[model samples]
Target: MTETLRPPASVRLVRIGEEHAGQRIDNFLLTQLKGVPKSHIYRILRTGQVRLNGGRIDAARRIASGDLVRIPPLQVAARTDEPPSGAVDAFAERLTPRILIDDSELLVINKPAGIAVHGGSGLVLGIIEGVRKLRPEARYLELVHRLDRDTSGCLVIAKKRSALRSLHEQFRENAVKKVYTALVTGAWNQKMRTVDAALDKNVLQGGERMVKASAAGKAAATTFRRLRAFQTATLVAAEPHTGRTHQIRVHAQFMGHPIAGDERYGLSERNRAFRQQGLRRLFLHASRLTFVHPGSGRTLTVEAPLDAELQSFLERCP
Candidate 1:
């Protein structure tokens, strides 16, 4: 499809719907006015050119159903290019076999490492975009949560707006159970344990936020169980009680047994040793997820088999 820019001529008023309720004001405007630059959107909001129900609101405000948004005239440039027809077909072909579950309300896929969940920050293609291209006839599709670019796992995609909202509620309420399989350096003596710590995210020199364990940060907790022990590395199952940025990785590090191949928070010497032993990607995988289906209230447990590469590396371990 060709990208088109709408003319900046008149003021417009849009009424919110249940589908858009609780969405950030800025995000809603970004979707409504697709071609506009994000900076310009913030500028208009700061200047009070955008109003909610005739009242000024900050960008952080959550819009509600039935609220009116007064949008000011603005100009925007079209996207430089669209993905080629062949690219769409190729993406669909690559992702189709990875589907783990597909129901009326949800689509779960065993996401491959190296592909991001959504496109942004210089990424040209992502799983969400690929799925959308593949299912153009589908009315709605959105990511239920995010996984690190290099973390392979069972990723969920909601098939309807109601499903999306319901899933988000479950996440917020901490009713979802997520389990991960990780290989960490050194022997894990504990059969079962919990790490309770507060984590803070700090933006560094180039605008990347790094999460660290700090007393003044948000509370985070994770439970880990030893699955097996190798000569130099131990395999464990990690269950996070509270979802925070880098909670599992950081908690593993806090336990004095940083995950193998975890360059961000692992011991460099151990990482080099693992690399020499033929390990490449981080030894972490979203092994399983247990939750009640939001649409049907049925108990569901989804699992993603470990990737072949990780399995091979483990076999080579002594």
Candidate 2:
């Protein structure tokens, strides 16, 4: 339930470093506040609750190192103790059999390709909720990074917010290594190739997400190495350099090898062919991720193998 009256959350200013001095207000807020809902900040900006130099300023205004900002008070909701939904319970049950690795600071899993990382739409709760219920003493676990709802593979979860922050920094700086495996349509003659494409987003009527090639979009680049070529499909190992939304999937489509069973940006004929071969979900999985540990500063690497369906599909592919 929404709080009828919100008291106030204090705002403070920390001088930006030389590198971030001219960042926009919204960007600065996102960096500092971390978890505040975007809509709430946009509303605050619209009402002129955020100020610069003792006067209201646009949310897009670039903030420099010495600039002062005043933020009005707000009623922040208390954290609730509601139990997660029944689906989360089911998802938790599934996760119990699928956990690949775990540690004091993290939970690593090979998420099946079809299941979402978390809940939405009609979903009551996500993996985190299920994980929490399963390991109740694991009070502070959080996702270090997100894999797509339909894409499967190794997913990282931080045990605490500090660890989460450190990991987020690592991702932001592109210091982590991520590798995805997929069955793409067509026989790729290129043993190795790099595809660079920009992504532009379009939101559907029911909030279905789509992306396209556009100059106005972020620079997305991915490198692919063909591991094995089937008669009609190729299994490729993909390494994305810049983590734009749907970068790997879009780049694969650009190569005319839309991942088999991928609904978005995939050819229906290829999808049908994949289904004929007994694939149910998109033929993609995050197989591995390597990074320096947030707490120990040691290099930490994790891998999730293809589930039974993918393993069987590869075996049958001629």
Candidate 3:
């Protein structure tokens, strides 16, 4: 159903909902006033044109449910192009089978490798955007966390603002449990389980991010437990204590046993050998996640089974 959206000629009042509570005012405005320039949004906020509960609030102020939001009149541009027919239907069809868990507050999907979590950096549509396009009826949807394009596993999405805030807090406090399975070159001893290293992030000329072990960087740690052993490779479960960029992959490299098929950090020789062994993508999969349900207040553990290709490649590993 297409509803006409007219620019408010004067100040407009918006009532916050359960799905939008605890979100910053600026972010809320960005979604509500789509296509409006960021500069204009901030200008209105800076000029005290935007208010929360009858009081002027900063852009970072979190608005709660039932809070009255004052938004000044603003123009929204018209769209130039419409999506092709059945585009959203086709996208939803492709993504529906990947859903592992879906509730009013949370969405968990077994994300496949080679697909980004969200669109950016030259890509048009990503998992989140695709979901939004497909589920036009959804009032609120946002990514709770991110996984690399090459990483496949249980990725979580928040269906409500409360869930998002709660999940973010859990991640920040390291209360959420995330476990990944990776095939790495060389035999890993059970004794070498923990890797305490500092990681520094750098941006390349092309705007790609590169993370390395550095003393001056943020603290990162990973605990690896050997799960299986091949002649020249080992399958291990990696648990990252700190959510730094590429922490698990970088820690695997630091241990002299880079993950197989990790093009960014793996040795070319081992990668070529793995490729010959039928490894087509990075051999890292988010196997399990444990956390408290934001809505239920109960501990929940979700698991994603290994993809067919990864299992096939493991079988080929001699």
Candidate 4:
């Protein structure tokens, strides 16, 4: 049987809470109006059907504690396909053991490969959602940064709005130190320690996003240090100076040493060879992160060792 749900016929004035202070208005509305289409939420926002403190506000405006949000009438369709409670519990259970750091203001985890940081693009759940389920008591939890779904390692989550803002400032100022471990095709030249290139991001006709080195693009740089050498590849530590979409991967490709098992921006022949040797995923891992502890104001570092699959593949490399 099809069922329909509708919001109140009259406008609502909701007072923002401290927990939601730093969140964008659109996101706050999504939480308040569950089951409403994201497009609908943005449409009302653009047309000023939504207002902040009796004034029209844009989607990007951050809400503050005690601010009044005026919501117009909304019609929402009931969702029948919510995942079962058991499934959500199982997902949270699997992630609990992967946590590397937990405190009053921060949570760090060794994010597993194949799980997106947040749900979108046809995925119903991601690391952030799972964490929410894991710690339902948390009033606020937000991703401090993002890692590609195929890359496994240290990921940070902020538990307070202040922490999120501070961490974001640190990232924007390039004060955070991130180190990644990657296996690239061919022997890395000892003296070739850096790749300074500009990358342009583009979406193809089929909707596949790609980044390539271009003369007119965002400036990016990555410092590379060879860690280990094998018969067909070299393991290197890559520290990106500027964070851009797929910066390290594109920089490695620009230097003629694309990461092994990287289907995008990589050599098909080399990928096939690595696959035959049991490399099933991209040979990239965010090995470590160093930043100021947002709550304590102390230097902190978190590390995640390579997973067994990656370790075993390295052992097999001649």
Candidate 4 per-residue lDDT over residues 153-265, each given as its tens digit? 99999998899878877887799999999999999978448889999887565446689999888899999999999988999999999988899999999999999989988
Best by TM-score: 1
Runs off by more than 4 Å, candidate 3:
1-88
- lDDT (Cα, tens digit) per residue for candidate 2, span 43-134: 67667887776778766466665666666665544335335477557667878887877777777877766555544334445565678777
> Which ten contiguous residues of candidate 4 have the minimum total lDDT?
1-10
lDDT of 1 by residue, 155-246 (tens): 99888878877777777678899999999999999899999999987656544547999999989999999999999989999999998878
Q: Residue 147 CA error for candidate 2 (Å)?
A: 1.1
Tell me the lDDT of candidate 4.
Answer: 0.86
Worst 10 contiguous positions by lDDT, candidate 2: 1-10
Q: Each candidate's lDDT (Cα)?
A: 0.83, 0.74, 0.83, 0.86
- Could you give candidate 3's per-residue lDDT for residues 204-249 as a string of tens digits? 6544568999999889999999889999999999999899989999
lDDT of 1 at 5: 30
Candidate 1 regions exceeding 4 Å error are: 1-16, 22-83
In model 2, the runs with Cα more than 4 Å from the true position are 1-90
Each candidate's clash count: 0, 2, 0, 0
Q: Lowest summed lDDT over 10 consecutive residues: which window, candidate 1?
A: 1-10
Decreasing TM-score order of the candidates:
1, 4, 3, 2
